[model samples]
Target: MAFRKTLLAAALALSLGVSAGPAQAEVKIGFLATLSGSGAALGQDMVDGFNLALEERGGKLGGQDIVLLKEDDQLKPDVGVQAVQKFLEKDKVDLVAGVTFSNVMMAIAKPLADAGMTFVGSNAGPAPLAGAQCNPGFFFAAWQNDGQAEVLGQFATDRKYEDVYLITPNYQSGRDQVKGFTRFYKGRISGEVYTQLGQQDYSAELLALQAANPSAVWVFLPGGMGVNFVKQYKQFGLMGKIPLLAASTVDGSTLPALGETALGVYAGTFWGPDFQNPVSQAFVAAFEKKYNRIPSQYAAQSYDSALLIDSALQKTGGKIDDKQAFRDALRAADYASVRGAYKFNVNGFPIENFYAFEVAKDAQGRVSLKTIAQPLTDHADAYAGNCKY
Candidate 1:
């Protein structure tokens, strides 16, 4: 009887211990991006960068096990909204990250804000979110929608590129790109053309640009759109006729496919592999060693996003529920980033220096970008003045 009672007690104790074993509470992070279609490359890069950071940090954020729920918005605003809704209402994600397009970010911003969920944008810095509609919950890990374009515009002005033609997609973000370019570009405006969003064909636009014969062309086509534009631009023989000065999109993500065609393109960006900082150097080396390719500004931005989250969590002692405290910690910018120096703007966007880069073949004969100049010094986006939060 005694032996049976002891065995029963042992079994009960084992069951209780199993039941009480460290209550695993999962912190779900929803990553919504254009996983298919034209923007898939950018999304894939972001995922790669994000996962790299997570792996480096041992798959934990804020001292908790992270459960990442990935959804492909396919560059559609409606799909983005639906994905965000599902994440917030059903999956109960602690945060939403990795939006690639401004339109998609705009669509889900207010809803995510209302839900009191943290929206950490790995890319897609729309103007509205930086300005009047800015919310405490929305933090941009990338530059503001127009910040890099504004840098490009200033670079063109300094170079005396008169009669510049501007081309961008006909979307809210595209419009903002043109506006940003014009804001600092004091030279004569040749013409402004807005193409359909994600339009694969740019032949008509090229013809128009050729007829205008602008001294320089400024374009803001990212992801697949950039791929299509560069290919079409080359086919039309516009590469030799006019110089192209564009945002980072021109070569950062498209260079692998663009190959020799991306040569001689000037791009302005906030981060690049050529940055001479120790942190950036180590990051570039490690990233290349692991991925067997150079990392783009997109990857750098996403990597920073993950590190920022980790830093904030560490600051708050890994408390995810203290949203206000978490935001404060993130705003403090306590972590070291590969970008060298970056701090949050009053509107929660990054306040970082912007550099102008030229696409050129490296010693290894691989196409890469080289930084020429820092166009913006301690720059702040124009929209930040309007933000109350």
Candidate 2:
């Protein structure tokens, strides 16, 4: 009888302990981007921005211990898919963030969504994803890929540039940029060229552009491709003659390497150093002090992305297991964003202001973007009409 009583008591104690112990409350987040190769610069900037936000939040997001798994996709679709799978299956990350390339974003969107993971896009904004194939699980923290380009196009038209040459990488995002630019620009398009995506050599295309002799050149090349193109355009002595107008690439990410070559160029974007918002100013100051360089728009977007996730987690009391509640919290746009007042469109993309910016040197001998004009005031992207949910 004594032995029987002892065994029953031990079993009861074990059961009680298992039942009373607190459940694990940690949240795992996966950050996927081109952390290596040509696109590394943009990826590093994004990582820096996200880290800064995490630090500001005391290294906790949504009231839980946030674990970030960083992966390098190398700008390839297959690699990106594999990275997302690993994050979803192997690491069991609850959310995935920071995909910079549109191609890569499309490659991983469905699978990540199917896994019931929240995928927040910090940069890439492919039109198709925004339209018919839009998923509720996918949220774009950055502006639509073409919204900034539209600002540049309208600015060019306003300035009365009769003839313009447009060039972009021959990819979905690149093609969408040209389309977006043309939507607002009413001038004669002397040339519209779509070059091979990730092609380093722009000499042949530049020569062709020179032959066309357009009044101005508008381009959309991000990361190392932008750096190489700007350097080569300068070497060909086309900078002064053609009057380069760009969208978020020339001065945002490539300025550090291009130096004086990037000066006097015109770009259109949603964020800049002179945005005159308290959140933006503080972010820029903090980033510059930490990295010894001006944070690009890519960095700004990523910072916002991290903060949004953290804010959503806070709303849920740091519980990431409740997918529906988390998604609702994200849709509420409850976080303080660095981009002033940012809200999500019906399609779960950002509805923000677009600014025309000029690359200029300040009194402190630093290169930064100055606001030249505001094209879109509280604008929603064009694809919002297609979203049923």
Candidate 3:
């Protein structure tokens, strides 16, 4: 009779949306990130940064041994969906982590939520996730799809860049960027251009840009696309002749490839390699030491994701089976984020400061990003109010 009661209790716990806790002091997490083709550097940084955080604790989180199952999304929505399904049906991970693009997140979010899975995303927060379509257990550690774009808009306004043109890959995130920029930009838009997702050559686009002859151009190109665009822009003699602004175009991941050509390019972000704070300083130093390269915003966010999981597990006494308990601990957000100031909004997005960065040569004559100005302080997203859950 006692044995029967034990089984019944376990069954009851499972039915009530609570985790029964792992049989052993072990937690399995499925980590998926884009790791091939065009934007692979961004994906590699995300994986390496998250691994560094785990290694710091001797491959443990909250006193429990962590089993990380990694997958490469290949930067495709269909591929990402398949990887996520494997995590659900085969690995049975306690939580899912690391998505490089918003499209992949959109493909995987619903299925994971439907399976009562907790997705601790480190990058790519689509607007709907912060608004009407929020999932109960989905948490994005990075800023929303529009967060940096909104900052770019404010930066443009502060600089008084009139007749600013826009260019981005034609995707949901691309559209979101334009929308967010227009929200705060008080200037006339010279034009808007959308290109293919992984377009390598921007020669044609650059020709059109020259014809437009806008006072300034703001772009959302990232990874190889950013490198190609900047190189072509320079070849077209538009680098210094026209003011080029962006959010993720010339970042740590692509800066090396761009070299001096990417110099003087301004971008907006919530954190950078030069972000000053003890926690951030340590992370940046440790990351550079291990990887021998400056960590990108993607890396910073993924590192935070690892910290978030560790902190939440600690709060739960190393128990991740309790769904609400784990989520609540995550909501508490007890870890010292590398970004210095970070808090999850009601929709599980962040409200933080944003800054404009210029790629400059430091005293050592090494290329690095220098924070020029703060565009937005304590900024929250516009769609959070509409989030139902």
Candidate 4:
């Protein structure tokens, strides 16, 4: 009877959150993204990238099994906040990653910082976190909100576009992008329009743009919004009349739908299908084999995020509870990135390159983004100057 009682007590202790041994320990990660609605494609690609990395590692990171919980933010701040609250307060997850949209990230950045949880952001680099509000726990594995846009703006300046019109979704990222574009483009402002976020119908905006007839039109729409806007712009027969220069408006995420219609649309990016590096080649081949679609900047950034986590875990021997050690390990960024060159700046955002890409048909006659011009090399975010640590 005594032996049976002791065994029962041990079982009770194990059930009450006592780990029997190190073998039983696992890393709990909560990955939240806008997995539905207008931003679904971007979030889906990010999830795929992270999953592919885990699959390659046999579903383990840093020698410990990962207990990953994926949640959909639905592109709404309130919904994202509720989901993050559960991850931080209830589940007590060790890490947080994969936020596809900026609005959701803006909503939860503060809470994650106050709780002292690390966010290995795969996407969505909001400007505030890269500046005065920067925190040690928030590491963005993607470009700053304005970095790519600044490249596009510089491209426009190089081309000597005299009058340019800007259109973007009305949100934090949208504002940041426009600010980046105008930061370099020494051009006369023809017009500026901010559309409702996640808006599907862009007829009014397209018509207004045609009426303006500026020397060039710059936009920052992504995902479904890009698809709809490009289709409408073509339908309204304004394709060749005014040049379209964009950032995130014409890329792998929307190219499947836009097809030949998106051909010749110029956009700015950091990675694409044509990257020749061995790491990039392997990642693209594996992603294509697994997903049967071309990997976009979305996938590349998220893939780097997973790789960064794996490398950091290797340094810490899979231990994540020691906040400073894990933070230091991540800061080291000892990993082979899918993008050619990658490292975190003082602000925790990436110091990388951005380039110009054009929508064109490859040898196989399928529409793809092709590298065109070198825009910004070893580019750091404009906000990094304000960050201390």
lDDT of 3 by residue, 1-389 (tens): 99999999999998997878855578999999989988788888889989999999999988789999999999999999999999999988889999988888888888888899988988888888889998768888888889889998999898888889999999878888899999999999999999999998888888898999998999998788899999999999999989999877888789888889989899998898887898889998899899888788888989999999999999999999999999999988888999886788899888889889998876567677889999898889999999886
In order, candidate lDDTs are 0.86, 0.85, 0.89, 0.88
Candidate 3: 10-residue stretch with minimal lDDT: 17-26
lDDT of 1: 0.86
**What TM-score should be assigned to candidate 4?**
0.93
Model 1 lDDT per residue over 1-389, tens place: 99999888778878777642356566789998888988888888888888888887678986767888999999999999999999988998888899988899889987988888887888899888899999988788888988888998999989998779998888878988888899999999999999888789988899999899999999998888888888888899988679988774565578988888978889998888887788788878878888888888888888889888888888988777889998898888887888777888889998888889988987688899988998898788999899995
Write the residue-wise lDDT of candidate 4 on 48-152 in tens digits.
989998998999987779989999999999999999999998998999998988899999987898888999998898888899889989999888899878999
lDDT of 1 at 108: 91
Cα misplacement distance, residue 375 of candidate 3 (Å):
1.0
Q: Identify the superior model by lDDT, candidate 1 or candidate 3.
A: 3
Residue 250 deviation, candidate 2, in Å?
A: 1.6
Q: Cα deviation in Å at residue 345, candidate 2?
A: 1.1
Spell out the clash pairs found in candidate 1.
none
All candidates: CA RMSD in angstroms? 3.7, 4.9, 6.5, 4.8
Pairs that collide in candidate 4 are: none
Candidate 4 Cα deviation (angstroms), residue 307? 0.3
